[model samples]
Target: MIIRTQVSFSVTGTHFTPSKVPAPFSDSHDPGVIGTVGRFRGAPVPYGSAGFEAPEKEMAKIAWIYERVSPYKSAMRDAGAEHCTLSVTYTYDSQCALSFSQEELKMIVDLDCYFHVDCQTAT
Candidate 1:
């Protein structure tokens, strides 16, 4: 069976960089493409309807995407390789610092955060 691991966390503060849209109406449009949407590489910009919004909106998007991408992240880590991964989830209640509360916490300011894990790598 295909094994998958999931982790949930909260976000309070975040950093978002906006990018310019490439291929405006073309089918091959990638906002993540550095310089195409924004400047510099290795940076993520807000996408979707709220593309040209504020950082807060982008941060909210970040939390949303992270929530959707499950298992794949942990699965990759288990294989072992020179890849970038962050386990800051579940440990951080907010985006700025590493603080978690026993009670339900919001991922972003005024934005509700939800998480779920399917596999267990450690207690």
Candidate 2:
């Protein structure tokens, strides 16, 4: 049952909350492909498409969280608990995703739905 939904979560008890940024009714494709509009060489560039300077934004919250916790042992784990929490939010067109892969289904389910935190820590 796919529906428009906004969900928030506390990252490892950190002060970051990934909230959903609602997409306008007339949204386009490649949400992560962030770019600016300008002239390249001689041709005009689009915003939604890739730009020459910046890279695509994927798992934005994860990236931000990494930046905050990169110095610690258990980067994510410790940051979410080491100091004051940071609030981070992410919005999506759909609430959740379901994948079909017999070999890796268990892992996907555990990480996605079960919230298994026993995975490997940052090295």
Candidate 3:
């Protein structure tokens, strides 16, 4: 017997504000490809069709998360003193899975999941 399962999650966190706005600003957007595989009974199965379409609204959400979290890390010697850490969070829905595979398990961690801002530091 083969069984299918669909898993989904969200990502959220607090990102420190950068001293200056970073270049190449990417609008909140979900990844073009955001699905994986699963197992049924005992065989490998695929999920969703090829070239899945992401929700338009999701793009905005993703961009927001990325922008808000960008300031958490500082590479410059004098990146403006940590101004403030902004709360960031986003949720991603995984495409349904029809089969299971070892590779699929490895990809689970990267799945679209909710993120919560726990804490942060400003220099």
Candidate 4:
């Protein structure tokens, strides 16, 4: 069972700084060679990211952030970013199944962003 889930969106590449990626990002940092929790590294520039998380709600977390970024796809690409992504991570206590509905996948396709999902057993 999934104990918690988080969904985040990011524009990252080796060319542009976070500042160049435009506004509305909740997290930003310079890239590093080694990655740490919540900090994406090794791009040599910066990562601009934003996330949406809610406690105890059943609504899909990805929906909460979709509207905010959907309109900026082109602008973000114009910022010299080589990639835009929607990353979902699930923390589970028992079984963790990696699956997605067609609608869920369509959202990612519409945004032209990579979809990355990770599952971890709760310790």
Candidate 5:
């Protein structure tokens, strides 16, 4: 029998850094030196946060892989089977931060496997 599973979740975090001006230019500068002076005030840049859904997808995939492989291998051994094949498929939904509704991300993965076991028969 073949089995498949799909999973999803929302993941979010502040993963991006705010842009900063160079060290010397960022510090206080004399106003009289117009050409050399740097602007002291600017709009606060918004840092980017990680999307919430990625981790969920990763965990789901891992669980599915483990479940499918381990049981199948055990079954094959118990049955004294010479070979077995395993396959996996996964799909991910759009992931976005709670603050942003328009942002979306998606990922998908698929894998296939073949296992072989051999037993020598008495001649």
Candidate 6:
């Protein structure tokens, strides 16, 4: 079963500040990330994370998450992001699968973004 959901986006570039991305939950800047595992590859450049960890109960549903993020498209586009990724993270205690609707997929396409889903199963 799902225990937590984080719907977020990230942008990276040498020319833009990440804090400018419109994220209400939280936002941060990292010089880089070091990775030792498969999914956590390291990035050695300016990185900004759009606020996630949506507190609103409705955000757990992907549609709502997309809706919440929709308004920030312009900010993301202008965030000086040489590249951008739109992602949804699920923290769960069991095995499961996720599905998406056309509307959800459209958001990614609309933004011309790379989409990734991170499923972390609790140990």
Top candidate, metric TM-score: 4
Residue 71 miss distance in model 6 (angstroms): 4.2
Among all windows of 10 consecutive residues in model 5, the one with the lowest summed lDDT is 17-26
**lDDT (tens digit, per residue) of candidate 5 on 4-91:** 2333211111322112212111122222223322352353322221111122335344344434334333333343333223323332
Clashing pairs in 4: 32-42
lDDT of 3 by residue, 1-123 (tens): 112211222221123112233423222112222334333334322221111122344533333433433343342113322222222322224332233245533333233223223222221
Decoy 4 TM-score against native: 0.68
lDDT (0 to 1) per candidate? 0.28, 0.27, 0.28, 0.66, 0.26, 0.62
lDDT of 4 by residue, 1-123 (tens): 988887877777665455555556676654433455543443333443333333236466665567667766666667656777778888999998767778777777887877888999999
Evaluated at residue 100, the lDDT of candidate 4 is: 71
Candidate 3, residue 42: lDDT: 43
lDDT of 5 at 40: 23
Q: RMSD of each candidate?
A: 15.8, 17.0, 19.6, 4.7, 25.2, 5.4
Residue pairs in collision within model 1? 6-117, 11-107, 12-94, 12-95, 13-95, 19-37, 19-38, 20-37, 20-38
Question: Once superposed on the true structure, which residue ranges of model 1 sit more than 4 Å away at CA?
Answer: 1-59, 85-123
Q: Which candidate, 1 or 5, has the higher lDDT?
A: 1
Off by over 4 Å in 6: 18-25, 28-53, 60-79
lDDT of 6 by residue, 1-123 (tens): 877777765556656555666555355563454544455566444444444444546653556555656677677558765676667788888765777778767766876677888999876
In model 6, what lDDT does residue 76 have?
Answer: 59
Please state the error at residue 17 of candidate 6 in Å: 3.6
TM-score sort, best first: 4, 6, 5, 3, 1, 2
Model 1 global lDDT (CA atoms, 0 to 1): 0.28
| Model 4 spans with C-alpha error above 4 angstroms | 17-22, 29-58, 98-101
